[model samples]
Target: MRIVLWSTAIVVLVVLVGVVYEQVGRYRAARDFPAPGKMVDIGGRKIQLDCRGSGSPTVVFEAGLSVDGSLSWSAVQSKVAAHTRACSYSRAGLMWSDASDAPYSARQVAQDLHEALTRAGEHGPFVLVGQSLGGLYATSFTKYFGAEVAGLVLVDPSHPDQVARVAAFMTETRSLRSRIAVWLAWSGLLRAAAPSLLPQAPNQTARDSQAVHAFAPKSMVTQLVESDATDASLAEAGAFRNLGNRPLVVLTSMAPYTEAELRGMKITPEQGKQVQAIWEKLHEDMATWSSRSTHRLLPNAGHDIQFDDPAAVIDAVMSVVETVRADRDNGSH
Candidate 1:
């Protein structure tokens, strides 16, 4: 009986210590890494918007799920900014942005972005570049604000049917893993493992990403919430099929899942191949959405094509931008 009581007390003490550590870490992170962009107030909440360069038809970047917010596009943003205005933002409750009590959905995210850009005095007829799940949000954005979108660049974008199609071969473990990650982040345990867990890039952006991964516990919660709403988000994105004659570029990464990755998912090599085929097919179909669309595949790049090959992303964006500009010039004449 005494041992049990002592064990309970020790557990309580450890939890208290952990909570304190997490709070302290959060405070320091806030102080050290302030929002590197404008925090545009959308009524009661503020979203971080980072814009650089100057031009018409601004290029906006949308990051993937479980990413380091705007920092996910760090490699490509500056290069694109050189040609025209390039902007990237953190979704609500990620990085330097405030949290939202509203349910997470692609529509909600799109609405938030629209409002943020408007409030920030950033006008549209914008070129949107979406990576992974961001692709879904971009599609939703076009559905709601079609007039404002000039073109789209999808970098290994997620398809609405990917979840259902892949489920036949591999069980969905990401949802469970994301939940565990949220708990780890909340308990401050994630801080210790974050450096090793996140991608190791040798640059200032990588350091900033590591800082966010270590300190932003709420971002983990946001990621989990978004994951839970995947069905609804997919449904919303699925509603939009055609982009008329708008310039579109679908960049598909053809790299196979690593042996370790396949093992972790409990998927055999054969199942992995099947899943890959489905992915490629979906991306190919996405290219057909527009009469003027290009589908490019990278043999060596992985899912995170922006990091694997920023040049590909940059070229795609530039191509779309040039197309939009030429159209505008022709119309003026």
Candidate 2:
């Protein structure tokens, strides 16, 4: 019994040490790599917002499920900034942003974004560029504050009905893997394996990689918490139908997984095709949300279309920007 107690105590001590070490590393990463954006206090919390260029209709970039946030749009933001005002912000609990006590619902996040922009003196009628989960938040913004949005560019956005539609197809193995990933993150094991968890280069820059590694735990937790309320958020968004005459551009990625990825996901070719078909169908449905909406497919791009083919994203934003300008000009006449 004494030996058993000693073994357990040692194990606990090791875990505690690992956690502390990981946290210290995270702190160092944050300290060493300073945020490029200004820290604006939206109430109690500070959000990192980076804006550039000058124009009437500001373009705001919203990131996906990942923690990189503004960094995710670094390339595209610079290009867009060349033409007009382009802004990218980190959501609460993301890199350089204060943690939030409020529920991570899409509407609440959208509200936070609105407050952050207002505090930063970035005005609208704004063009919203949202990818993956950010697309949902942008939709919430449109529904809640339609007057503020001039246009929307959704890049491989997540569908509200996706969970229900794919529940049967989802395997327990995937859930188990996800749970293991969360556990690894919480225990600081993921930070130890940061290199593997955060691949550099095409996926991210050196600075972005470090930030992702340091804040991955918080980011993962935020994603799961937000995911819990997706159903309710979707229900609320569904209520806001017919987005008036707002111009909407939906970019859908129809890229297929490589053989290695297919093997990892254990998805057969037929199953993959079915999934793609469903995804495209949902994109088509999303396009119908606005009378002036266009849906385009990126055959060679993946879910991160902005990252894969940023020029396409830039073109989409520019198209919307031009349309908005034209509309404004015509309205005055």
Best candidate according to lDDT = 1
Tens digits of per-residue lDDT, candidate 2, 1-333, equal 999999999999988988887788777877886777699999988998999999868999988877676888976898899989999998888777888998667778888899999999999989999998788788889888888898999999987887676665544333666657776665777667667765663545677777777777766666666656667867766666566778989999998966755675567877777878988999899899888999999999988888788889999999999999999999931
| Model 1: residues with Cα > 4 Å off, grouped in runs | 175-178, 201-204
Task: Rate residue 90 of model 1 by lDDT.
Answer: 95
TM-score of 2: 0.91
lDDT of 1 at 107: 81
Tens digits of per-residue lDDT for model 1, 1-333: 999999999999988888888888888888888787799999899999999999978999999996488888888999999989999999998888898888788888999999999998899879999999999889889999999998999999999888887888877666666568677775677665566666564333656776666555767778777877888888889989888888999999988888977987789988888888899999999999888999999988888899888899999999999999999999931
What is the alpha-carbon lDDT for the whole of candidate 1? Answer: 0.86
Can you tell me which runs of candidate 2 are displaced by over 4 Å? 172-177, 180-186, 201-203, 259-266
- Global CA lDDT computed for model 2: 0.82
Query: TM-score winner among the candidates?
Result: 1
